[model samples]
Target: MVAGATSQASAALRTYPIAPGVSVNVRSGPGTHFSIVRTLVAGASVPIYCQCPGETVSGTYGTTNLWDNIANGQFVSDAYVHTGSDGYVAPQCS
Candidate 1:
């Protein structure tokens, strides 16, 4: 069975890349200082369970205070992610 399969299935919020051809780093935390857990390809869609404020990042879309929770303990800067809004589109991470 896949890890976090139930949670993944239940996640309704999705975010896409804001910049074309540029892969975004998925980190253990919400900042660039954190260790990179993986990389999400540009134009790839990721399920965002929630958001939280972290290191500010400026990207092609704009600056944002939100970081996307793409998986269990996995975060990516919201600045590079197009969530269809500038504000929090999902619940705040706990």
Candidate 2:
């Protein structure tokens, strides 16, 4: 029962698609000045755990200062993610 509940909750988390044909850089922090921790695979979809203001970037989605937190210490520019919204899609990072 507990496992089923956990699965349901995990499944409820929404994943947003990355820009097609682009392998986005995952940064340790919300800005480009932060070290690149990894590169997302092309066509990857990510669950935004939170969001925060960051360096303004221009990408397939246009320019924005929003950064999506996909994991602890892992962030990607929202400009490269297609969240279908021009604004915040998740809670702001604390």
Put down candidate 2 lDDT per residue, 6-30, tens digits, no spaces.
Answer: 6645753889999999999999998
Cα-based TM-score, every candidate: 0.80, 0.87
- State how far residue 66 of model 2 sits from its true place (Å): 0.3
Writing each residue's lDDT as its tens digit, candidate 1 over 1-94 gives 6975666445564455546777999999988899999988877877778889999888877887578988998998888777788888788998
Clashing pairs in 1: none
lDDT at 59, model 2 = 95
Model 1 ranges with Cα > 4 A deviation: 1-18
The TM-score measured for candidate 2 stands at 0.87
Which regions of candidate 2 are displaced past 4 Å?
Answer: 1-8
RMSD of each: 5.6, 3.3
Could you say which candidate leads in lDDT?
A: 2
The lDDT of each candidate is 0.81, 0.92
